[model samples]
Target: MDLILDFFLVSGIVIIAIILLQLFKVKHKELPQKVLIVLFLLLFFVAIHFYALLHNIIWLIHLCFLPNDITTTILGPLLFLYVKTLFLKEDGLVKNTLGHFIPAFLFALGITIPTMLFNIFKIDTLAYTHTNFIRTIIRFESLYFTLYLFISLQLLSRYRKLSKQKYSNLTQYDFNWIKIMFLSALFIMSIDIGIKLYESFWGDLSWNADYISVLCMIVLVSFLGYYGVNQSKVLLPSFLLNKEKALNIEKTKDKTLSPNKKEEFETLKHKLEQVLHTDRPYLDEDLTLGKLAQQVSTKDKILSTLLNQYLNTTFYDLINKYRVDAVKEKINLDSYKNYSLFGIACECGFKSRTSFNRIFKKHTGFSPSEFKNNTL
Candidate 1:
């Protein structure tokens, strides 16, 4: 009991310390900080309950009296919330936020209420082995395991989707913390299950090993809190054109490289413009600066410089100008009005209705429909 108390205290302090720090880590928050906060609080709850059990605290002793089972119950909900928060904040999937826990919570109630009633019904057997509670916890712990595996799978899917997203100036912020968290959950659940299994088959012998699991969990929570509290710099990826406008100084390199830099840049710009003119490659779905640079035998850095300084526009803005011109020409022809603005956008060069409207409005000071009504 003393050993268990020590385990709970160490882990408990770590848990609470982290949470307090996270509350201080305000201003420019992200998924990582939120995750860390939740983790710290959850561990604190688990550790406190266990510490109470070790001391046979009366209110706790009367209220269910099973430290391990109570902790087990809380774990499932905490983890469910963790995963749900992750999917909601990171992906903006609002529908998925609270819905994922209904099935798990319902199934847990099946195990929890039944196990409690059954224990009351069988005090004789419980007294002999001191592990009737352990047997009961197994069923719910299995549910927790399945929930965790589901969360891991979902995270992997999100990782793949994020990899494919365009113009994500977001950086990977400490996925290592998440990996450690998942592994810590696995280890604790394993110990809980292992203890129950051994007590059921071989009889309750020792409680020494549980301390190791608690310490591991505490360390995990403490680390998560540290990561939460630590200051992470944001890249603040403002649009390049906006940034250039604000800075206002000439963007060209100092002590200009003779005529060489300008000449090289002009050649590359002309080559890309030629392709842009021919294939109307600006219309292609994946026509990024890197892809365009490859075709034109130039670096994106050099092309960007030339486009901004000489053409007086960003590559995105420059590409959209052609699209706008195409749309205007089509609208000028009475035959084109038969189709809608969405149709006209596709005919011009846009990939989606939203992208078309965004770029069109930026270029032409009106929505596609508004521009068409005024001009066409």
Candidate 2:
């Protein structure tokens, strides 16, 4: 038994040590608050469970006095925080102050109060004495565990809802690893709580071993490093949202168009250039393939094909290139020098200062004002 406990115990500690080292690697990167929270929960679990391993070594008893309820109480809420941190937009609902921690605080207090009270009065019964206070604590443990389950369910449902809606602006979030970590922890905690509840009712400690809990703790601690090592944090840009991207390759793909359709496409493309040079497409943020296709008397598929093959860019980029060109021309004009660069971009059909600046910088490597100043 000691040999088994020692093997699992050392393995758990080594895994956590690796995770701690991995955190330093991504210290410069943007870590969402929920990821940070998961990191701390893992650290806490390791610290307590490591002590359990120490106690097992010294006392020749597995699981020592370090109860499973400590980590079992925390797994769900930490996962709930993870969901909020990943997919939420600006100033989301999860951004409350310390009040949000009341549930966790109360649970921690439940554990501390019992142990502290036991120590203060030398009430050996929580360990040796079978008392009402211990029973009450177990009951509250079940209630909080249930609350955590419900919260996790809500987070999962909300994640599905937001993902299905396909919000174009916030597609950058990819919490796939964190999602797996949360689910795994949730599974372990559910079983841990079930055991606690059964023990509280029947006074049987079936399947409650310190070694098993310690093994799971090691796996949970690896969550921080696992995602960082395997994945990238590059966010999805606004232009790529819900839009099919053109494949990049040396060989041109077969267009599958007939002789009559080919002539019609060339004619329409020429007319589109003429109309766009006259009126411009950059002025409208909602300018899409369908809209462009209609103005030129062609279908969306034909226009999309042209944009994909000839331009070697998405429809969004193709339009933005023209917008940038127009912005530069306006900036060069001496008459427009009297107005702000933003005003110049507005006249060139840019809807917002931010869009104008972003698209211009993407192409020109300079902001609108910066480019204007340099040209002037």
**Pairs with backbone N, CA or C atoms under 3 Å apart (clashes), candidate 2:** 125-129
Model 2 per-residue lDDT tens digits across residues 129-224: 236775566556545655665676666555543332222112223455555765675676676677766766888664434445556757766665
Per-candidate local distance difference test: 0.58, 0.57
Residue 329 in candidate 2 has what lDDT?
A: 78
Candidate 1 accuracy as lDDT: 0.58
Off by over 4 Å in 2: 29-70, 89-97, 120-130, 139-143, 160-174, 206-210, 228-376
Output the TM-score of candidate 1.
Answer: 0.47
- Summarize candidate 1's per-residue lDDT along 9-117 as a digit string, tens digits: 7656665865766565677666545655654555565576556657767465334434344454455555555544442335553345556556546544554444554
Rate residue 124 of model 1 by lDDT: 53
Q: Which candidate is the best by lDDT?
A: 1
